[model samples]
Target chain A: MKFTIQVNEGPYQHQATDSAYLFTKAALEKGHEIFRVFFYHDGVNNGTRLTTPPQDDRNIVKRWSELSAEHDLDLVICVAAAQRRGIVDDGEAERNGKDATNIAPGFRISGLGQLVEGAIQSDRLVVFGD
Target chain B: MSEIKKFMYVNRRAPYGTIYAWESLEVVLIGAAFEQDVSMAFIDDGVYQLTKGQDTTGLEMKNFSPTYSALGDYEVTKIYIEKESLEERGLTLEDLQHLTWEDEDEDWAEKDSIKLVSRAEMAQVFADQDVFFNF
Candidate 1:
């Protein structure tokens, strides 16, 4: 089955991101296809490259990037929500006149239509949110 | 051609103090362009999001309550408010802004969009949906 996962909270402070990651991992391990992982609201914060957790921690954002690299996951952050929360990619930073971009690798900024499309394209649209 | 899927935006948060309500609205508005069969369900504290006299003046927020009225313009005519949720919160149909849509097929006759459903009815609505964007 193809799955599109939505994460609605940021990393660390909320368990939604962790749960989404684990679920995606388990699904991929079971040989199910992950259509996309669309991040919204505070979930956009998970795409900021500046997130630095303690060395002993799980490194949630890095984990997502590595997983995406391994399995070619479509990591999408809502542009409107991301802009409101200061999660900027290089193109967005340049367009918005920001000093720098901090978006983590393997994640892309997109419109909310991406989520809608994911719903239409995927077999299951699973949400892990607060 | 692709089949039109049933999409429901589940609103369960209060209008303010949290960003979920507004963000969910944004998604709905954007999703409207996809031409999918979309509907909205306001339950729990989410019913407060549609109050008629919403005053964000003191809070200094954008006061997006008015935007709900324009949902009909996007052809999103279904707004389901749980009957039990309203009764539990001591609210009635009169407390909310009357949302309506002009049906072009019906010669532009304005029709009510808000549908009051019992909890069981709401459960059936959920089961009918192919995708749910829950807040």
Candidate 2:
């Protein structure tokens, strides 16, 4: 089964990203093909490299970044949403004349068309949103 | 690829006080360029999105309700509003904006785009869709 996961909320503020991450991980473990994971709205916060949790807490952003690295996943943050939420990439920082880029590893900024394309290409498009 | 798939945008939030409605419309507009069989389903608080005569002067937010009118121009002709949702919100079809589309096949005749459907019917509509994006 091919799947496209859409996370529509922030990492810790909402449970959407955690659920999406766990679902994607479980699906991958089950030998399912994850075509793409498109993050939208506040979900773009998950791709920020500056996320820091306490020493005892789970690192949500790092976990997603590592998961994508292990699975070779296509982790996409909607460019429009990311720009609004301050999730900047190197290219975006350069183009927008910003000083820094905070996008985590294994994630790229893109358009909403990627969400639509993921839906069309995958067998199922699961949305984990609040 | 010439393949066409059924796509549905499920709206269940009130228009203002949040960014969901606006962002969801952005996705719909972008998704329209895909030339898929697209449909917009308004249920629960989402029914308020189509209500006519919405004013946002003091709110300072850009009123995007009018953009729903232009959807027809983008070939998004299927606008489904759940019947029970309207009733629960104390709104009738008359309270909603009239949406219509021009059918070029019929010599450019104007046609109604709004389809008031029952909850059961809306579920059937959902079941028929290849993909659903909920907001």
Candidate 3:
């Protein structure tokens, strides 16, 4: 089965990303395919490339990056949410004349339509929230 | 159900803390206008949305749970609750007006139509749907 996972809350507030990770791992372990993982609302924070958590704690951003690289999962960050939260791609950073973009590797900034598309295309759609 | 689009609206916030619940309801209403089949699953603090007779006049927050009652008019009738959440909050079916709570004496695993379910089942609800929106 193919699955689409949506994360709505931001990092640190709830275990949104962590839950996403666990679900993704479980799906893969069960021999299920991950269609996409779309981050929206405060979840856009998960795509921030500059996040640096303490060494003692699990680094959710890095873990997501690793997962994407291993499974070739589509990690989509809502563009509007990203920009508003100061997470921009290089193109967006240049377009807006910002010196930097905070979008992390293994994640791409897109639109809500991608989420809509993911929902329409996937066999199953799961949400991780509080 | 004629190949209808299935939407799962996940409510995660408290009833009056923010506009999450109202905004989610508006989306559901819009989906219903388009003749979509909508289901709502409340988790965490969102369960408070089903608690009855809330007075928000002084808090200046809209009593949004009433809008949930209007869902039937919009053709949205399916509502689900997380079992562990209810247990965690010590809230019983008597605390919620619209909740379809099963009798404690029943032998059924999940007897209530407006039933309580496990976390994995909650996640499965999202997976089973075509469009799952969280608020």
Candidate 4:
């Protein structure tokens, strides 16, 4: 089965990000294809590269980045939501006249159409949020 | 060619208090372009999103309640409002806006788009969907 995971809450603010990560890892381990992981709303916060956590805690963003790298995942952040919350990639930062870009590695910013595309292409679309 | 999937957007929050309601609507508007078998379920506080006479003048935010009426034009005609959610909030189908859509199969006859369902029936609807989006 193919799955598209949607994370709708920011890291640390809600358990959604962690649950989505674990679910994605478990699905991949079970030999299922992950079509995409589309972040929307506060979920875009998970794509920022500047978040630094202490050594003792699990870095949720880093975990996603690593998982994405390991599985060649299509991790996307909604451009509209990311702009509203200031999570931008280099291209977006330059386009919007911002000084810096904070989009973490392995994630790209795209339109809401990706979410619809994921729904159309994947067998399951799981959403995790408050 | 890819098969047409049954997509269901589950709205569980009230409008205005959070961005979920508006963003969910945004997804619906975009998803409509896909031309899939799409449906929306109003559960919990989501029922408030369709209440009539919504005014945002004092709130200083865009009053998007009227857009729900435009959903029919996008071929999104199947809107399922959970009966219990309405009753829990002291609301009825009468309190919601009179949403309608033209039924092309019925010679362009305008028909009510809202379908009130029980909790059990809503659960069945969920089971029948190919994809479920909740916000």
Candidate 5:
């Protein structure tokens, strides 16, 4: 089965990001295809590279980056949502006249259409949020 | 080609207080272009989204309440409002805006777009969905 995961909350504010990550990993371990992981709302915070947790704590952003790299998964952050919350990639930062980009590794900023596309293409669209 | 699927957007939040309600509408508007089988469930505080006489002037917000009426123009006609949600909030179907859509298949007849469903009926609607989006 193919699954598309949507995480709608930020890393630490809610347990949604953690649950989504674990679910994605478990699905991959079960040999299922992860079509995409689309981040919207506060979930776009997960794509920022500037987060620094305690040395002993799990780094949610780093975990997602590593998982995406290992599985070659598509981690999409909604461009509209990202812009509202200042989660910019290099291209977006340059275009928006910002001085820096903070998008985490293995994540790309895209439109909301990607979420709809994920729904159409995947066997299941699991949403984790408030 | 991607296969069409039954997509249900579960809305449980009130508008303006948070960005979830407005952002969810954005997804639904974009999702409409995909031509999927789409439906929206308004439960909990989400039922407040359909209430009439909304004025955001004092709040300095954009007043997105009118957008709900425009949903029909985008072919997003199946809006389900939970019966219990309405009653719990001291509201009824009459407290909501009279939303309607023209059914071309029915000879361009204007039809009510919102459906009032019991909680039990909503459970069955959930069971029928291939995808569930909650925000």
Candidate 6:
């Protein structure tokens, strides 16, 4: 079965964004196809390339990048949400004339329509949040 | 046979805590606009949405609980709540102003479409949905 998971909260706040990392890993471990991972609201922060967690803690950004790289999953950050939170990729930053972009590779900035499209295309859209 | 596409919108925060509640409502509206059957589940702080008599007063935000009623107009009438959350917060059915009690329906109480259920059941519902989103 194909699954499209939406992560909309946590990590930045008191909740856990690790849900995004764990769910994606579990889906792949189970041999299920990950249709996409749509990050909306504060959840878009998960795609930022500039996140630096404590050395003892889990590196969520790196985990997401590795999962996307190895499994070839579509890791999408809602562009509107990302822009609102200042999480721009190099292309978006350049278009907006910013000095630098913070979004990581393997993750693309997309519109909320991509989230809607994920719903339309995937068999299951499991949401992970607080 | 093709499986019916089921969409579940997870409202995780309070109605006024942030823009999450409003954005979540929009996403659900979009899902219904696509002719998909959509359901909503309130968890953690999200239960505040169903609480009665919210006075935003000086918060300078919109009171969107009424929009919950409008969801039915969009063909999204199934709203679920977690039982443990209700008890943990000391909220009962009466604490919610908009919800109709299951027992109130003489014939449908046993099968009332909208009401509260246990967390385990909520987990099952999550597993059942084709499109599950959090706000």
Best by TM-score: 1
TM-score between model 4 and native: 0.95
**Best of the two (1, 2) by lDDT:** 1
Lowest lDDT block of 10, candidate 4 chain A: A118-127
Show pairs that collide, candidate 2.
none
Superior candidate under TM-score, 1 versus 2: 1
Off by over 4 Å in 5: none
Model 1, position B9, has a per-residue lDDT of: 96
Q: Fraction of reference contacts reproduced per prediction? A: 0.71, 0.62, 0.21, 0.79, 0.83, 0.33
Superposed model 3: Cα runs more than 4 Å off: B1-4, B10-16, B19-131
Cα-based lDDT for every prediction: 0.95, 0.94, 0.77, 0.93, 0.93, 0.78
TM-score of chain B of each: 0.98, 0.98, 0.81, 0.97, 0.97, 0.82
Q: What's the residue-level lDDT of B118 in candidate 1?
A: 97
Model 4 Cα displacement at B19 (Å)?
1.0
- Maximum-lDDT candidate: 1
lDDT of 1 by residue, B1-135 (tens): 177999999999999999999999999999988999999999999999999999999999989999999999999999999999999999999999999999999899999999999999999999999998999
Residue lDDT tens for model 2, B26-81: 99999988899999999999999999999999999898999999999999999999
Interface RMSD of each: 1.3, 0.9, 4.6, 1.3, 1.0, 3.6
* Candidates, DockQ: 0.75, 0.76, 0.13, 0.73, 0.80, 0.23
Lowest lDDT block of 10, candidate 4 chain B:
B1-10
- Per model, state how many residue pairs clash: 0, 0, 1, 0, 0, 2
Q: Rank the candidates by TM-score, best first.
A: 1, 2, 5, 4, 6, 3
Pitting candidate 2 against candidate 6, the one with the higher TM-score is 2
Question: Which window of ten consecutive residues has the lowest lDDT sum in model 3 chain A?
Answer: A111-120
TM-score of each prediction: 0.98, 0.98, 0.59, 0.95, 0.96, 0.67
Stretches of model 1 off by over 4 angstroms after superposition: none
Q: Write the per-residue lDDT of candidate 4 for residues B17-130, one digit (tens) a residue.
A: 899999999999988888899999999999999999999899999999999999999999999999999999999999999899999999999999999999999999899988
